[model samples]
Target: MASTLTDSLVGRLVDGRYKVDSRIARGGMATVYLATDRRLDRQVALKVMHAHLADGASGADFVSRFRREARAAARLTHPGLVAVFDQGVDGETSYLTMEYVDGTNLRRRLHEDGPFAVGEALQVVGEVLDALAAAHRQNLVHRDIKPENVLLSTDGRVKVADFGLARAVTEVTSTTTGTILGTVAYLGPELISTGACDTRTDVYAVGIMLFEMLTGRQPFVGETPIQVAFQHVNDDVPVPSTVVPWLPAEIDELVCALAARAPEDRPHDAPAALVHLRRVMALLPPDVLGRRADAPPPVVSFAQGTPDDTDAPSSVGEIDKIDEIRVGGDTDEADGPVRGAGATDHLTQALDTRASGSTIAFTLPDRDRLAPATGTAPAVSTSPTAPVDADRPGRDRRRPRRRTLVSVVSILLILGALGGGAFWWFGYGPGSFTSVPTGLAGSTLEDAEARLDAAALLHESVEAFHDTVPAGEVISTDPGDGERIPKDGTVELTVSSGIEHFVVPGGLVGASVGDARASLSSVGFTAVTESGEWNLDHPEGTVLGLSVVEGESLPHNTPVVLAVSKGPEPVVVPQVQSLTLDEATEQLEPWTLAPVVVEEYSETVPEGKVISQAPEQGSAALRGDEVTLKVSLGMPFVEVPDVLFTPVAEARTILEDAGFKVEVNYFMGFLGNEVRSQSEAPGTEVRKGSTITLDL
Candidate 1:
C-alpha cells in the first residue's frame, strides 16, 4: 500500500527530515502518509492537513486546532494512545509526524469481520475509554470519537488516534460561529444543541462506538444530517440487546447510560464511564464473553455524511424543529433569526442567538411539564340570561379542596415508598459493590488470600500455567484486579504452577550437546548427557538423538537423556598377507574392509600362494576402508624361437639370444647344426630360462 500523500508531496521531504514514502490514508482534515524519519531512522506517520483546511476558510483557528492535536497527543503517554513525535510545516503544508501503527482501523475491521464478540467488543471499547480517560484527566476532550480513529494492531494492541478534533476543556468554544465540528452520529445532545462540549461529549461518542461494535451498527439513522442530529437530540439510544437478543442486560445499560441525552445523567467523565464499563464486564459470565457461533447480522443504517455535516441545516424551521422536539416544546417563534446559506451558517445562527442574549425558549409539552392544577371550582355567571350552578355551595368547594389535598398526600406517600425501594434495589442492593484491591496479581497466594479474607470476600484457588509468573504466585484474579464485585462475592484466584509441562523443542535435533542441554534446562527439563553410538553421519559432540521424541510433552524437571555423536567407529586391520586370495578376502570382510587382488610373477612364491597386503596387519583403519592384496603367480614364460634348418653358428646365436641352452644332435656325423627337431616344438609354450635341446 502506498502512503496517502498527494502527487506533489509523494516524494518530497517534509521539513528536511521526514522522507515521504507513500500515502496511507486521507481524511477530511489531513492526509496521512507513511514516511521515514531520517534523523531517527524510524518509520512515522506524517499527517499533512489539507491546504485549504490549514490556512483557508477558518485560517488561524483551524491551524491552531491542528497544532493542538500534536500538543494533546504529545502530552499523553499511554500504550493505547498513538505517540506524537514532531510537528512542522513546509511551505503551505502543515504536517505532524506521529507513531505509525501497523494495523487496520476499527472501521475497516468492522467492515471486514462484522460485529465483535461480547468480550471483544467490551475489551476494545474499554481500551479506547482508557485512552480517553487519560486525555480527560489532562483536561482534554476528544470531541471526535469514531471507529475510524480507533486502530487495532496485528499484535492484539488497540490504540486511539486522531486528536484532530481534540480541544481543551477550558476552551470557551470548540469553533467560531460559522464552524461546527464532530461526526453527527456520535455527537452528544449538548454538542449538537448548544455547541458546548466537554469530557461527557467524549464519553457519549465512546458509548456510540461501543454500541456499533456490539451490534454492528450505529443506533441512529436518517436520510439527512439534520434528521440524524435531530435523533441525537431527541431520541434515546436503543439498547443493543434489542438487536442482539443474547447480549447481556448489563452491556445495554452501560451503553445507554454513557450515551444519555442529558449530560448530567451520564457518567461525569471518561474515568467514571470506564469504571462502570469494567464493572459490567466483570459481572458477565464466560458464556456471554465467548464467541457466538450464530452472530447477529449486520445492521444496515443510513450512510453518515462528512465532518461538515454539523453545519448542514441552514434554516430556522429546522432549528426550531430540532429544538422543539429536543425540549418537548410546541410554540413556534415567528421572529426567529433568519439563517444564511453556507456550510456553517446554521451553526453561526445557533451560536449567534445565544451570543445576542436572545435565548430560544425551550418549553416542555403540557402533559410532560407538571401535574394538572387542582382545587379549582366552577364560578357562577353574573350576566343576564347566563346559566348559574345553583347547587354549587361553599361546603361543596371545601369538600372538593379537602378531597384534592387527601389525594395529593396519598400520591406523595406512594411515590416516596416506590422511590426508596428503587434506590435500595439499584444502589444499596447486591448490585452495589466495591472494586477489588489493586496489584493483586503477582502477590503470593497466601498474601492474596489474606487480603481477600480481610475484605470479607470469599475466594477459591485455581491452578494454571503461566510463562512469567513464578510458582504459587497469583497469575490473575477472575474478576481481575480493580473490578467491582458484590460484597462477599466469590472470586477465583488463578495461581501459576510454573509451566506444568512443555513440548521438547525441535530445534535441539541438530544442535550441539551444550546447546541441547541448555535448551532442555531452559524449559524446566534436566538433561543427562550420554555417549552415543559411533556414526559417520553426524560430527562429534553433536546431538545424535534424544530419549524422548520432539514435541512430546513431559512433566517439569523430568530427566532427559541426550545422545552425543562419537564419529565413525575404527577397525583394526587383520593379517591377510601370505594367505590365499579366498582367505584374505574372508579375513578383510570381518573387519568391514574391501580387498583388491593383484597377481604378479614371483621367483620363490608358489603359484596361487599367500599374497602381501597394502595395509599391514594390526593397522588401525575406519570401517569400509580399502586394502590392496598382491598375489603370487609363477616366473614369466616366453615362447621358444624356431632354429630348425639353420646353420649351427646362427642357430647357436639365436638360441643364446633367446636365452635357451643349445644342444646339437649330430645325426650322420658332420651335419650342420641344423635343428631339425627341438625339445620345444614350434608354437609350444615353455618356462623362461628353461633348458631347450636342439637336434641336428
Candidate 2:
C-alpha cells in the first residue's frame, strides 16, 4: 500500500491541473483523493487507478472502457447525481475528477445512523430514484447502486455516483468469493444467473437498499456469501411489516413491487418507481411522514486505508476462508435487523474489503429482478477470478417441467381407458357440455387458454382497450366462468391488449366542435373538453386545434382539449338610443362594437340626441359588429317668408305654404290687404308648425 507520506502523487500536481490533497477513501478499483482544480478553483474527488491496471495485460481495453464510460457519466446532468468533470491518463496513472461530496456515503450512514423511519427511508429512496431517472432518460444504466456509491451531502442533499464504471472494470475483475461476494450482496438474481441487465437491475438494488433503510439490513443472510446470493434466487423478499409491526400495509406493498421476484412484476424504471413511491407518500398521514424511529448504535466504518502501490490486484483472494455468518439482528425473523450493541458489528460493511479493482458487470437477464461478516478483510489477490457456473435456475427448471409432464400423462392415461359407455356419454351424450372456469380475468392469455383447453370448449379471441387490465390478460368472456356451455360452443374471449391509445384524427383543427367530438369518440378518445376563445377567423363552436398535435397518440380517456372558437365576443349595445350621440359613441367603443351615426329629424327629441339604434338597444352584437345610431335633429325647421308688406291673403298663403300657421289681424277696424306683420321675424328659423301672426 502507498503511504500518504510516501505516495508519489500526494502533495503534487497531476496533468498540469489537479493538486492532490489528503486521501479520503479507497475502493476496490481506485483511490479517492481530495484535490483542488487550479483552473476551476474548486475542490474535486480524484479517483486515480492503480499502476498495474494501466500496465496489465488488458490495459488498453481497460483504458478505452474507462474513458468511454467516464464520458457517458459526464453527460448526466442532475442535482442528485455526482457530476463527472473530466477523465484522462496522467502518464502511468489513469484518473477521473468528480464533484467532491462533503458528507458520508449511504453505507457509512446506514452503519452509523440508519434503520430510518418509514418516512425518512422513503424520502432518501425517492431522492435516489430522482437521480436515476436522469440516467434512464439518457439510456444509461448505473450498473452498481449499493449504499457505498450513494453520497449524502452535509446539506441534506442525496446524490448517486459511479455511473458506467462497473462494466469497465468487470472484464478484468477476479471472480473469486472475495471479489464477487462483497459487491454481489445487493445484486438482483437475474444479473447473477443470466448476466443480463437493464434499468430494472438498478431498481432491484434500490429496493434492497430501501429495505435496508426500513429495517436496517438486507433481505437475505447465510453461512457464506454464496448462500446469501442464492437466497435472492430461491426466496421472495418478505413484507417489511413482518419485521416492524407498526408499518402500514402500503409500505410493504411498495417494497415488494420494487423488489418483485420477477423483473416484469417490478416497475419498468426509476421514474415509474418514483411515481409509485410518491403516491404512497401522498396517502400516508402527516404523523407517519414526520415520525422518526429509534436510532441504532453507530457501527464503526473502515479506517482510511493506505493507497495500494504493489503490482498485484488489491483485494480478490480473501473469499476462500469464509465459514459462519453472524448478523446484527435475528437472521430468521423476516430478515430485518433488531436494535442492539454491534447492531451491525461483525459486518461494519459486512466485510467492506478494498480491492485493487474488480466489479460484477450486472449482466443480468430481465428474468430477474445479494453478503457476509468478518474481521477487517486482509490483502486481496490481483489474479483474475474465473467465472463460476452456478446455474441455479437451469438446475431448478427441470423439476417443475417433469412434474407437469407426469401430471398430464397421468390424466391422459386414466381418461383413455374409460369404458365405451362412459366415453360415449361424455363425447356425444348428456355429459358433452363443460362448465367454464372462474377466476380467469387476471390470468395471462396463455394461461387462460390452457384452462379453456382443459374444458374441451372452442373459443375465439378478441382484443379491446382496457384501462386497468394488463396486456395479454383475459378481460372477460361471453360465457362467464362457471356457466355451462356445449363442448363445441365458441366462447368469445375479450383479452386486454394493454392500455389502448388513439391517434388524434386529422382535419379536427377546422371542423365544428360537434364534428370533432364525434370523430374523437369514434377513435376511443371520449374524454374531450372544450375550451373556447373569441376568434374572428372561425365561426362559433369551430374547433381551432387540440391540446396535442394532430397525429399524436394518447392513452384511453386522456383529456383532449378542444380549442374551439366562441365566435367573436358578443357586444352588449347599451341604451344608446336615449343617450346623446357623443355618449352613445363612447359607451359602444369599449364593447368592441363599431358605431355608425345616422342623422334624422325627430318631433320631440332635441338635436344631437340619439333617437334609435339598429339591432335595438341592449341587444347582443358580435365584437366589431356595426351598431348604427340614429341621432335626432329635433323638429324640422323652415325659414319664415318675408310677409311684412305683402297682401294679407298672399302672406297667409305664403306662410301656409312654408308649413307655418298664419293668423290675420285687423289694424284700426279694417287693415290694408297688402300690409301685414308676422308673429315670427322674416327669414327666421322656427318649428314648421309654429303660429305666425299676419297684420292686414
Candidate 3:
C-alpha cells in the first residue's frame, strides 16, 4: 500500500539471480528495477508484476505471458533488440529479466525539454524501426512499442523492450473487465479499432513517437482515454510538419505511411518499414545526422497570466488543481446541483492556492518504488486536526422568535419589489438588445475571445477539461449559444486544457547519453539506468533505450537512466591468398571483403590460379574492404613478325625470309602501292597467331 521506497519491497533478490539494485520505472501493471545479475556479473532490468496483477486470479495469465515473452523475444537476435535473459518467479513475485539498458526514455526527454531536433528525432525513429525489424522477422509483434517500452542504452543504441508483454498480460486477464494495458497516446490505429495487430502495429507506435519527438505534441488527443483511442481509429495522423513547419517532406511521408488508419496502408512489417525509414534517412543531408547546432532555442512563451515563478509544467500528478467551468447556464442535471455563482469560484480559488506551491513527489534510488505518486499520499503531510472553536455556537444562535418573524416579513416585502424590477429588465430594458452567437464553429479560444471582445461583449474562458475538445477550443458559450442577452453582457466559454502533459522518457533512439541527461533535466524526469545496447552510429556513452515512448502519460520524476551503446565493432580483413576464389570469398565474408582479380602472366604460376594479392595474407583491412588479387596466366609467348609495309614483290620476299604473314594492297599509279604504314612494326614481339591490324 505504501508508495515510498522505504516501505516498498525493494533491494531484495528475486530468484537468486537478480539482485534488485534500484527502481527504474513503474506503470499501472508492473514495477521495473535495475538489478545486477549475480551469476553473469552483468546488470539487467527486472520487471515485477504489480501485486494486484500477481493475484491468484491473474497469476496464471501473468506467468504464461512471462514465459511466452521469453520464448518469443529470445528468438530475436538483433543489435536493436533488448535481449531477454531470464523470466521466473521468486516466491510470490513474478518478474522478467532483460538486458539492463542505461539511458533515459524518450518521454522524459520531451517532458524535460520541449521537442527534439529534427536529426535526433529521425535517429530515434530509425533505430526503433531497426529493432522492430528483428522482432517482425521472428514473427513476433511488440504489441506495446510506446516510448516507455523503447529503451536507449548509454551508447545511443535503441533496444526495444516489452516485446509481446502487453498482449501476454491481456491474455492473462480475459475475465477481468477493465481497460486494456497500454498508453492511450501511442496506441496504433488497428489496435484501437479491431484489437488485431501485427508488426505494423509497432510501426504505427514508432511513427506516433517520432511525431511527438519532432513536434513536442501527440498527433491525436482527447480528454478521456477512450476518446483518444477513438481518434486513432477515425482521424488521420496529423502531420508534425504542420506543427513544426521545418520537418522534411520525406520524413513527413514516412511518418504518415506508418500511421495509416488501415493496416493494409502501413508497411507490411517492421523490416519493410525499416527499409523505408533507412532510405528516407539516407536522403537527408549529412548535417542532419546529428543534432543541429544552428537551431535556435524554442521560444518560451508561457500562457498569459500564468505565474512567473511556477515550476515548469510536469506530469499529470504534479498538477495540483484544475477548474473547469460550465459555459452558459445550461448546467446539466448529471453535473449535480449547481452551486451559487461566487461559491464555485471560492472553492476553485482555495484549491488553486494550495496547489500553487505544493511540492511534487519525485523518484528515488530504491527498486519497486521508482515511480512518483504510486497512488499513495505524500510522506510529509500530517493528518487533519480539529479546530479549537469546535463547540462554539456563536454564529448559529438566533435572535428572539418575534425578531426572526419581523425580519422574514420585511425580507419578503423587499423581494417583491426586486421581482418587479427583474420583470421590467427582462421585458423592456437593453438586456434584450442582443443575442448570443449560435456556434463558435471550429474557432480556437484565442480567436473566439478576440472576436467577442471586439464586439463589446465580455469574454471569460472557462478552464474546463473535456475528453473530446482539443486544447484551447471553445466547448460552449455563456447564456447558451443563441440565447438572447443584454449588450455588453458576458459571453462565457468552456475552453479545453487538453490532456495532461507528462515527463518524456530519456532513452529515445539516436539521442546520446549527454543529450538524454539534458533532456531529462529539462523535463524533470528522474529515472535510473538498468541496461543498454552497443551501436556505432550513436556511439557509446549515449542513451540507447527507454521503458516508454516519448510523450507518454506517466507519473512525475520517474528514475530513468541512459543506456549507452558500444560503438560498431571493428574487424580486420582476413587473409585470402593461396586459396581458391570461392574459398577465399567465404573466408573474407566475415570481414566484409570485396574481391577483385586481374589476370597476368607469371613464369612459375599456373593458369586460373591466384599469384599475388594487393593486401597479402595477414594484411589488415576493415569490413567491407575491397582486395585485389593477381591470378596467374602462365608464361608469356610471342608469334613471328607479320609485316605489311613492304611492296608486293619486296613484301613477299621479306615474308618468306622472316617466317611472317604478309598481305599486299594494290593502289592506282597516282597512289602507289608502296609500303605506306604497317599495323605492327617489323621484328616486334606479339602474341602467337594474333591478327595484325593494318592501314594503307
Candidate 4:
C-alpha cells in the first residue's frame, strides 16, 4: 500500500484549470486527486508527483521522463486502457490529468474476495492481456503489470491503468538512472539479472500476476526485496496446482510456461499469451470454471524444523547471501554469469555442513535445481563422498552404495510417472480436444446446426433477445466460439429473437431536441417530453441534456426523458416614468433591467426626474434588458436681457430669441410701445424657455 504525504494541495488548483477537490490515492511516486477540469466542465484525476521528486536537482529529469511516459500512454486509445486527458507542470507540482475511474483496483478485490474462480480469473487476465496486446502492437511495453494496475469498474468493465512505468519496446533498459524498476515480485529474470527489458518481460509479469490471482498470494516472498528478486532470477515459478490442487492441469502448465526463468520460454507477446490463455480456458470443465470458493490456506514452510530443512526456504539469511555474488554493480551487466565460483562454493559448503548435523537441508548446487518447485525431481547429488563415512567397515560402504542406488532408482521412477501423467492429461485428454465452431454468432440457426453437425458436436437452442443480431440467428454459444470441447460434446446455442431491446447511441449531448427525440423513437424508445428550463447559454430548442447518459441499454418502449432548452426567461418591464432617477433604478432592479439615465433640459419636469423611458412601461423584455431613461435637468438658465425701454413686440422678440416665453400685461386697452417692467428682473438668471410677463 502507498502512503500520501500530508501536503496541503487539496483545495489548490493546478495549472489554473484542474481544481483539486480531494485526494484519491497516493502511490510511491505520485498522489492522485479528484478534480474538475474547469475548461471542459468534466471530472478528471489529477496525478501530482511528489514535490521532492519534482523540484530537486534531478527533478527535471524525472519530470521529463514522467511527461514522456504520460504522452505515450495518452496515445493509446482503447476502451480497456484508462484515458489520459492532459499533462503539465505548475510551479513545483508536475501533474497529469486523466480520466477518473470509478471502481477499485484488482488488488483491493483480491484482498476482499480472496482468489478468483478459474473462469473469472481468466476473464480478468484476458482483458488485461488484450489491453497489453494493444500496447504491444504499438511497440509499447507496460513495465509494471500488477494487480494494483488493473481496475475493475463498477459496470463490469476491466481497464488497465498506471502506465507510469511504460516505455517503448525498443528501449533496452528500464531506466537511464541504472536503478532496477518494477516490483520485485513481478520482475522478470532477464530484467533482474541483465537489466534488459522488452515485451516478454511484461508477459512474464502478467504470468506472475495470474499465479497470484489464482493462489491469492504472490509466488515469491522474502524478508527483503533483493531476496525476492534473486528468486526471480534463480528459481522457476512453481505450478499453481501445487498450491491449489483443485486447479486444472492446463492452468498450471500455462502459468509455469509463462513465468519461466528464461525469456525464450514465455510467450512472445501479449497476443501470443492471450491465445494460449483462451485455449486453456476453453478446455476447463464447469467444476473448475465455476468454483467460487476461497483459496486453500497458505502452507507454512517453517513449523518445527531448521530454516534450511523446511519444505521451502524460510530464512532470508541464505537468500540474501546469493545477492552478494552480484554486488558492486555486477547486476547491471547484461553478459557473463552472475553467480561466481565463491558463491557456489559457499552454498555447497553450507549444504554439506548442514547435512552433517541432525537437520536435513534441501539445498543443491546443480543447475537442475532450477526446475519448478512443484512435484519435479528433488535435488540429489550423485557424488560418492557427499555425506558418507568412509572409515566405517567395508560392509558399511557396500550398504551405503546399495542405499544410494535404491534412492536414485526410486527418484527416476517417480519422475517417469509424473511425466507420463502430464502427457496423458494434456495429449490424450482436454489438450487434444476440438474447438467449438467459429462464426456461430449472428449465423442462422439452420446454418449453425449444420456446422455443429459437421463438427460432430451436439447442440441445444436457447432463445434470447439480442439488440444487434437478427431474429432466428445465433447470438452466442454456451461454450463460446473457439472454445475447446470434447468430441461429440453438447454446445448450447442462444438464438436471437430480433431486436427486442433498444440501445441508445452516443454523441447525443449537443444534438437538437427534435433530432434527439426522433433518434430515440427510431431506436424503439418512447421519447417523453420533460419540462424544460431556461438556459441562457444554449439556444432555444437545443437539447440542454438527457435524463440518462447515452450508450445505455434499456428495455423496449422505455420512456427517455428529453430536456430541451427554452432559451432565456422573459422579464416584465416595470413602470418608471415621471419618477425620480433613483426610484426608477430601484423599481427595475427586481426585474434585472438596467436603467440608463440621460439628462436634458425640460420645463414641465423637475431636476433628477425621469421624464420618459424607452419601450414605455409594462413591456415584455428579457432579463438583463437595458431600459433608457430620459431624465430632466430642469430649465436652462439665461439672461432676461435689457428690454425695459423697448416695445412689447420688440421685447417679445428679444425674449423669444433668448429662449423664453413672453406675455403682454395690457391694462384697459393701454397699448404700450415700450416694455416698462418684466416679470423677471434684467440680467437675472432664469430657466430657459420660461414664460416672462411684460408691463405695458
Candidate 5:
C-alpha cells in the first residue's frame, strides 16, 4: 500500500532513517507507504499527510488534530482496531506510522462486490461492534462509522479504522474546533442539530450501517446534506420488515430503538446493544444457524418485504405538517421536529429563528451508567439537551404498599411454579442425576465428560479473560474439588491455563551494537535498530531502548528493540608492524580508526604490504572519531617515465634527480649507465625518497 508514495520518497530518508519503499494506500488526506527502516532491516507502514494539508496555512490545525486523534485512538486496544505505532513530524511532513493491516476496506469491498449476504454482514457487524464497545467504554465516540472505516481481512477478521473524529465525551468541552465533520450519511441527529454528541450518536450511525446491511440501502437519503440532517431529526426509521416482510418485529424494534429520535430510547449503550444482538443471533432457528468449527460462525437471515414508502421527508417541518403524535411531551405539534413543550417556544425562537444564542437545558435520568450514579439520584441537569420531568415521584416515598405486595405475590407464584417443574423433572420423575468430577487440568471437555461418564456428569464453559490461564483452560469451578453432587449434575471444572508471559527485551535505550544484539538474542527477542545517537539515558553496547514496555503479551516471536553500548571514548591509532588487518582495526577502535584496505608487491617484504599509514598513525581521536587507514592492496605498477628512453647521460641525470640511485654497467652492447635494464620496473609505486636501483 505504501507503494503509492515511492516516487516522492524513493531516495529521500525520512526522519534520517526511514527509507520509503512504495505506496501502500492513498486517500484525500494522506498517503500510506511501505517503508524500510534502514537501520532496522524491517518493514513499516508510513502514513504521510497530504502536502497541501501540511502547508503553512493549514499545517498547524491538521497537525494538532492528527496528534490528538492519534493519541486517543492509541488508547484503544482491540483485535478489531488498527494500532498506531508512532506519530511525529518528519521535517515539513507530518506522518503517522501504524500497524499495516493486510486487508481491504469495506468501501473497497462494497465497490467491488456490492452489498454483502446476511451471514457476512452479521459477522462484520459483530466485529465492528467489538471495536466500538472498546472505544465506547473509554468514553471515545467515533462520530464516523461508514463503510470506509470498516476493514475486512482474508482471514475473515473485521477491523474498524479511522477514529479521526472520535473525541472523549467529558463534562467540559475539550475540542472547540466546531467544524462539524463526518460522512453525511452516517452523521447523527444530535451532531447535526446542536453538535452535542455522546455514545448514543455512534449507536445511531451503527444502526444506519445495519439497516444498509439488511435492506441493501441507507435509511435516509437526500440531494443535500441539510435535507439529510432534517431527515435524521424528524423521520422515523423505516422498519426492516417494511422492506423485507419476513423480518421479525423484535429485530425491527431493535433497529428502530437504536436509531431513536431521542438518545434515551436507544438500548442504553453499544455493549447492551451488542448483547441484545448476540442473544437474538443465538436464538436463531437451528436450520438457519450453520456451524463453523474453524472460526466464529456467522448468523444469517433476511426479512422479506417489497418496496413501500421510500419518500423520506425533505425537511424537519414535514414531520409537524403530517403527524401530531406526542414524542417529547409536545401536543398539537405539526409534522415537524418535535420540541419539548417546556422549552419549545424558546428553543424554536433561538434555533429556527436564530435568536442570540440561548442555551437549551434539561435533566435526564442518567440511566446509562453515564454519571456518578448514586442509585437513581434526584433529577439534575448536566447537558443542555437532556429532558427533565419534575412530576415523577422519588424512590423515598412514591412506591405504594399495594404494588409491593402484589409484586411479592407474583414473584412467589413464579418461583413456586418453577420449583414444581424442577421437582417433577429431577426428584420424582424418571430423570437421573450426574455427579460432578475433579482433575479437569490437561483434560478436554470431552475427556472430562468421558471420565465422568460413569458418574453421569456434564460440563459447561464459562468464558473469561485470564493472564494466568490459557483461553480454553478452565480457571476454577462451581463445585469445590472432591465435592460430591447428584449423579446427573454438571461438573464445572476450574482449569489452569498456563500464565501468558512475554519476555521483555532490555538494554534497548543505549546499547552498543554487539551488546544490543546479544541482549535481544538472550531474551528471545528480535531487534530493530534505528540509526541515531544513543542519548544520555542509554549508553552504547547495552540495550539502549525498547518500544513495548515489559509484561505486554504479544503473540509469540513479536519483534522488540534493544540499544547496545558502543564502548568508551576513542583514542589515536597506534603504529603497526606485523599486525593483521583485524588486529589493526581492533587497536584503532580506541582512536576511532577507519581502515582503508590496499595491496602491493615488494621484493624485500611480504605481499599485502602495510606500506605505512596516513596522519602517520599517531593522530589523536575522540569517541566516534574517523581515521583513515592505508593498507597495501599488493603489486603496485607504473607507466615508464619519459626519460626512460633518453641517452645514457640524460637517463643518469633523470634517475638521480628522481630520487632513484643509478648505477652504470657495460652490457654486451650498451654503454655504462645506459638504461638497458632496471631493477625496479616502470609503473611500480615506490615511496618517495626510496631507492629505485637500475642497470645498463
Candidate 6:
C-alpha cells in the first residue's frame, strides 16, 4: 500500500466530510485509512468496507446495519474508548469514523518490548476494562478485544477501539455468512459452543489478553486456528505463573477467573472482573509490580513495519477465519468472529456471532506493536514506516481485474451521460434558475404572467400607480425585468393601477376661503387661485365657491380658483324727491337708509313732502347712511301799509318787493297798480301774491 495516484479513495472525500489521506491498514472486512475530517478539521481513522461487501447483493442491508452499529458506538462517550464520531454511505462506499490515536497499539508494544511488568500489564488491562465497563453498562459488548483494539495514545491515554462494528457483519460477510464473527485467539468458549453473547463474553476475551500480557505468549497454540479455538472450549487457560514462573499467584487467578469455560464461572461482566483485577493489583507487592516477570523479546524492525502499519498479516499468524472451522474451509479467512473473538491483528475484524462454550477466532490489524514497560516507558511514537505491497490479511490477491475495451468504452459513455445530466440539472434544468421575462415593465399583467409561467418562474402581483404605464399593465418586476431568478422562485410583479388622480371634495362652499383651498390642495389640487366676491347669502371672508367645479376628478396638481366673500353690494341712495315722509321711508328700506326730516318751506310746493335728499338720487351710500329731506311750507304773508295814499308806482314797487302782486281796482272795473283798498283785509295773513285795489 504505497502512497500513489492510483491508490483508490486515498484522495477521495467520503460522504463529503472525511478526506482519505493515506492507507493505514487493511483487514478481511474493510480498510482503515488515515483521513482528515473536512467538517471538523481534525484527523480521523476512516474504515471503509471493501468493495465486495458494499457492492454485493445484500449491500443495502449491510450498509444499513453498519450505520445502525456505528450510531450505537457513537453514543458511548468515555475517555478510555476510541470515540466513534460518524458513519454514512457515499454511493457504494460505506464508512465509519473514529478518533485517530497517534501512538501504536498494545500488540506492537509487546512486539517491540516483551511481556509487560505486573504494574504495566495491570495499567493497560485497567484501561481496557474501564472502556468495556462503560459499554457493558449500556448493554453493549465489544465482540473483538485484542492488543490491536487497545490503542495507546502519545498523550499517555489507553483507549479501546471498535465498539459496536462487529455486530453489523453477523449476516453480511460473504465468507462467514451467518456463522462466527472476532479472532480465534481470544474467542470465549460460549461463543464457540453456543451463539449467545453478553458482557461476560468480553470479560473472557480480556482474561485471555491478560494471560498473554503476563507470560509473553498466548495460553493456547496450534498449527491451525481450529486447534486454538477448540482449546478454549476443552481446556482451561493455564495459570500465567506456569509460563512466567515469577508471575504472582493473584494475577494467575485473575486470568483463570475471567477465562473460565462457563459464562457464569467468569466474573459476571467487565465491571466485576475490573473490581477483581484492581483487588489483585492492591494485593501485589510493589517490587513485583515494578519488574518484568520475563526477559524482553529482541527488538525487530521491518521496512514495511508491523501488521498495524502495513497491509501485511501478523508475523505470529494471528489471522483467523471462523467460518473455516465452522463451515469447514481449507482456506479464505473469514472476517467475522464468534460473539467474543480476539485474534492476532486489530482495527479490522469480523462481526460478533455468539456460540456457547466455544471460542471463535477473528483476525484484526494489530496497530499496537509499541514499546511497553512496567512502571515507566517512553509514552511517545515516531512516524510509521511505509507500507509494502504484499500478500496481506483480508484481501484476495488472486481477484482478477476487469479492464476490457468494451467495459472501458461503456464506462466512458456512462460517465459522459452522467456529466451532461449533472450539468443540465444544476445549470439549466429545474435544479438551477432562469431570468425574469424581458420587456415586462409595461406589458399587461396577463402577458407577463404567461411569460413567467413559460420560463418556469412563479409570480406575485402588486398594484401601484404608474405615470406612463396603463392600468392593469406591469409597472416593473422586483428583481427588475430580465433579472435572474430561481426557476421556481417568485417574481414580484408591480402592476400599474393607472395615473394617480384625486377629486376636489364637495361641501367646500361657505367654508373659510383658506380652509376651502386647503381641502382642495389635500386632494392633489396644489395650484389654486383666490378672489373676493360679494355674496349676499354667505358671510364675509367665507368661500363664495370655486372656479373649478367641486367633486370633479382631475390629475394631480390641477388648478382651482377659490371665491371668497367680501359681503353684499354697496347700497344706492333712493330717489325720494317730492315724496311724503312715509313714502320716502318706505322707498329707503331696501338700502337700510335712515330718513332725517327737517321742516322746510317751499313757495309753490305743498308741505310735508320730501323736497330733496342729502345723498341725492342714485348715489352710493353706506348701508346705514341717512338721507336728509326738506318738506314744503306755505309762503310768507305781507302787510299792506298806506299803499292807497302812496304813489301808484311806489305802491306797486312795495307790493312786488313783498313777493306779492298788487291788483288795482276802480269803482267800476278799473285796472290800476295803486292800492286804494285791499281785496281782503290788509291785516290778514295772505300769500305774497294777494291782489290790492286803489281809487284813482
True lDDT of residue 686, candidate 1: 71
Instruction: Give the Å shift of residue 51 in candidate 4.
Output: 1.4
Greater TM-score among 1 and 6 belongs to 1
Q: Residue 192 in candidate 1 has what lDDT?
A: 61
Candidate 6 wrong stretches, greater than 4 Å: 1-5, 164-178, 295-309, 312-696
Please give the lDDT score for candidate 6: 0.67
lDDT of 1 by residue, 401-508 (tens): 798899999999999999998889767887667678777889999999999998888998766554467999986775667877888688767677775576788877
The regions of model 5 sitting more than 4 angstroms off are 1-28, 33-45, 55-59, 111-114, 171-177, 267-269, 289-696
lDDT of 2: 0.68
- The TM-score measured for candidate 1 stands at 0.47
- Stronger candidate by lDDT (1 vs 3): 1
Q: Which ten residues in a row have the lowest lDDT in candidate 1?
A: 313-322
RMSD of 5: 16.8
Candidate 3, residues 446-479, lDDT tens digits: the string is 7887777766678765454334567888766645
| Residue 287's lDDT in candidate 3 | 62
Off by over 4 Å in 1: 3-6, 54-57, 172-179, 293-300, 303-336, 339-696
On TM-score, the leading prediction is: 4
Model 4 TM-score?
Answer: 0.52
Tens-digit lDDT track of model 5 for 1-696 = 223322667557789877876665554456667677676566666767776866788678877877776788777656677656678888778877665556666645544454555456656777787678767766788777766567676676677777766778872134443344555466666655555678878888888887777666667754333344457766778887676665567658767867876765564456656655676676666443332112112222111111111121111000001100111332335564433342334333323332111111221111111112134568987768553455755544434567789999999999999999898878755564433566665465556657667565666543333343565665555454466566556754544334323466544444456445445434433224444443333444455446567655563234454434444454665786446667777877555456766555543444553656665656665555454544555444333344554567887677676656566655665655546666566766664445554556
lDDT of 3: 0.58
lDDT of 4: 0.71
Q: Candidate 2 on 1-696: residue-level lDDT in tens?
A: 233665667898999999997666555456777789997678987878666656768878657756775787776656777767799877788888887877766766666675787788899999999888767655666766777667778799888877744332234232222222224556676655444466777788899888778877567754344455557766898887776667788989899988876776676668667767888898999787776555534332121111232222221111111111221123425644433323333232343332212222221111122222335668887988674457755566567679999999998877776766687888798677777888877888888888888877777776654667888988776567777787877665767777768798899988988678768755656467789989977888899888977788888467889999988987777777788988988988788777888898887788899888897877878888988888898789889889778878778888899888877778887856665567788878998778988767
Model 6 deviation from native, Cα RMSD in Å: 41.7
Better of 4 and 5 by TM-score: 4
* Model 5: how far residue 170 lies from native, Å: 2.8
Backbone clashes in candidate 5 total 87
lDDT of 1 at 232: 87
User: What C-alpha lDDT values do all the predictions have?
Assistant: 0.69, 0.68, 0.58, 0.71, 0.56, 0.67
Better of 2 and 4 by lDDT: 4
